[model samples]
Target: MLLALAVVPAVVQEAVLVGIGFHGARGLAPQVTAVWPYDSYHDLRWLLIYHNSWWHFLFGLVALAVFRGLLSAGLTALAWPGQVPRPSFAWLLRRNLEVAALALVVISPWAALSVAFSAVALSLYLFASLIPMLVLAPFLQRAGVARTWWRGLPTIELLGWSVLNFAVLTIAGAVISSTSGWWGVLVAALAGVANGLLWRQTVTAAVLPARIRLARVPVAPVAIILTMAAAVAAQPILNLVTGPPQEWMPLVVTERLPDRVPHAVIVIAGHDSHWSGRQPADPRVERFSYQGLDRQGRPLPYRHTATHRSLDSSSVLLRAQVEALHRRTGRPVALIGSSEGAMVARTYLEKGPKPSPVEAVLLFSPLIQPGRAYYPPPGYSGWGVATGWELRGLFWLVGLGRADRSRPDEPFVRSVLVNAPFYRNRTLCPVAGVRMIAFLPTVSAAEAPPGEYSRIPVFQLPAFHGGLIGRRAAEERVVDFLAGGHVDQPRREYALLQRLGAAWQAPPLALVLNPVWAAEREADPAFTGRICEPR
Candidate 1:
């Protein structure tokens, strides 16, 4: 019954979205022809607001309330067995409407901010609003509970669970809405079922019943499996529909010289949803091959659309491609990797069965230990610190699988960081022969211990993470390095370190008291640096 009720809203929403050409066929089908919708947050938001009516939004809110009420009531009945009476549809509907009304009221202020400010502001407001709701919603529900329930309520656990649940639902909804045809409908139905089960379990835990004991359903596994399956299925199809993957293929912008030069440059793009490699217009190197396939073997069209699977597979593929290029051209390769691509290059060189044809490997803002690399240090104080952390947390939650279908690189990157040791252990092939050079930003350089690996030479660049890829001086250094020439003047920027020392630390309550501080950090020179380097 709970599943049936939950599915109604999902089916209705899908139908309505499709009918209005907002979700299926005419809408997502056309947009996702060349790219997946995982990273298209702004576009998706605009579509929802522009294509959908106020009635549609209202209906969705009401449906959400009804579903929550029914699920909670059903779970309560099951848990108490003989003690609690089964709620009638009308009673459940009434309770749900009341709960929904309260929720809408709480969220309406944040929602109204959408009119005055950007969606980003509204999103931050919405996230801020959810913290209180997570803590209070269980208590607010009319479901019979002991007076002492509030005293024993697990606030932290409930908040974490709510965050996880929200992540799952949001990802599921995004996938469903972005997909077209019967496939979208089918995925939406599965998501609805999963949502119902998750809600039932969450309610069961929140409102602990005194009498009857019911066996716990494996909600996490079920949701994970459902989400993973949907993500994997959605990714490749979206890629195929968006257009030919050739547009994303590695382009040989400059023709190779008739005489085979000993060294060739192979550039691997960082964690982006598009073909992001920028070939140097240098005439010294004959050929340049940009990495075409993202970690998931799909064409990268923009940021956040590609899916990421095992780095091992991608590494193997990279090795094969590099080897083929080397064999055909009869030239030794010099690999230049940025961000996640740098990690892939390292993996390939360290783990591949065949020895790398490359003589030199250059890593720009390479993420070797993701946990350490991406983490904000204790003394760091920036405007967007809290927001950045929250966004990172959300990405981590959404990307918890073999493939990050919705937000491709984030989870995979996190997995790589967490499993760095595992990959390191698999480094049976020696990299002593490869002259690896690492160009790290000041902030990242602080985290990375220099000379950890004797063979790889780590240089501290006076730039931000994104800046390393775009700076002309950095690019020239890369070109020189590929040509087996050394960087003349390597300098460290201690400005970030000095600023970290001088800036006042944000209080723990700052997240609630002044959430704007998170955004402020982004603009702060102390956190991001004073240098205006392009990415």
Candidate 2:
């Protein structure tokens, strides 16, 4: 019943939001209806990455406060004794708004910071899962949520939900996850429902009568996985009717790279990793340099810096190398880049002059933002009706020489964050003709999933930043994708991510099955034109 209650409102919420054309902001919806563990943190994350417009985002927040807030409070009131006086609407609204504001201002950033650091990623996920049960449940219970499966059992804390979650995570989470295309959303939601079932003793005693009771404890796992499988299998056929996800890309990873795969490719190393090291044995693959260094790995007068000029410099070298390789092999060059080098590859595709050279790009955890480890998008979204002023503001920022010009990665922090079209264009529209896939570190995204907000088909790896650079599996998957062969995800590592409280599911189901995919695209733009355009 608790789980069903959560799902029921989610359908209504998603429908109303989409019916009004705000699917981009749907990330703000509970991962699985109302059983969401972290409310404030997720709400803010969706607003920045998946929002349609500031108005839409704000409207969603208000709706969350009014509808969810009022409903939750009403339920709490009803759960208490009949003699108790119900809280007034004004009081409920004020309390909900306060909690929402507090989350947006204080708690959200702190949670984001905890996830950004790799060492703390798993701990953060645990804390996130616990927030709903340990913190919110108790608070509401104390505030008169009289009935819960909360009886104090004998050492059940040591033997119950923790063990159950751990077992489910180890045996099923990731493997079952792939079965359903909607793994990210549905499993996340169901797991959310399961999170509250930790009170085995109390739940068994009370819930056996009221509803699904503890059956959901075992049943949810089966439902989530089977549902995901059906969705994934059905998606390709459905796409025939709806058309391909033009802007969205779907990809997977592996464990090893075949040594003798016959493909023409170029390898771009991350910051400071140049041709000085032992080169790859395969003659089909060549490594390029952007630090103005000689082919023998000697440094030149110019050094790489965090400016647009460095991007132009490396992009020019990339063009020359791709053209050379293409001519030699009589085939298009496939780009494989790691870290900062991946950003260089991204810049070339986005801003490098027409007629893209590379046919396929495999980027290992590219830096999407310039300055900060994580930077949320500014509000407003688009230029409303007048798109021309978008270009004018960009020109004014560029012509006025306003970039900080740091000396680390490719672009200055201000360039991307301050609307200079740093990595992605400030206007944030999709460009044509380049097949690109990004492999992201699961640890980095364990808590705050930056890739979820990206338009690129981001493949989650069990490895950390720079972890997938030479992995044979990733290399093999890249080869398979380039050759149009079968591509699938790694088997075991995904469970590690799931154990840490994230749904390490693949992306295709949402792209195909979810009707609000276009809104998701809008929500996940690089940057928007809200600054000078009055969106």
Q: Which candidate number maximizes TM-score?
A: 2
The alpha-carbon lDDT assigned to residue 446 of candidate 1 equals: 29
Weakest lDDT window of 10 consecutive positions for candidate 2: 504-513
lDDT of 2 by residue, 225-306 (tens): 4333332233244447656322111122112235444457777665434243344455566666564445643223222331
lDDT of 1 by residue, 1-535 (tens): 6566545556665555455433211112211110101112112222223212345554555554554455434533433333345556565556544544544444333222221112111122223333343334333332222223323333344445445544554455445433445565665566556655655554554455433222244332343344334322433454477553332222222433223234766666655434444334433232222334455333233333442544666676677667665665677877767665676777777677555687778776664222211222224433223333333434345345725333312445435533433332221123667766777665453222111222345566666553566566666566566556665344534423422211011101111123322332222111221212121
Worst 10 residues of 1 by lDDT: 30-39
lDDT of each: 0.41, 0.41
Q: What is the C-alpha RMSD of each candidate to the true structure, in Å?
A: 21.5, 14.6
- What TM-score does prediction 2 earn? 0.45
Native-referenced Cα lDDT, model 1: 0.41
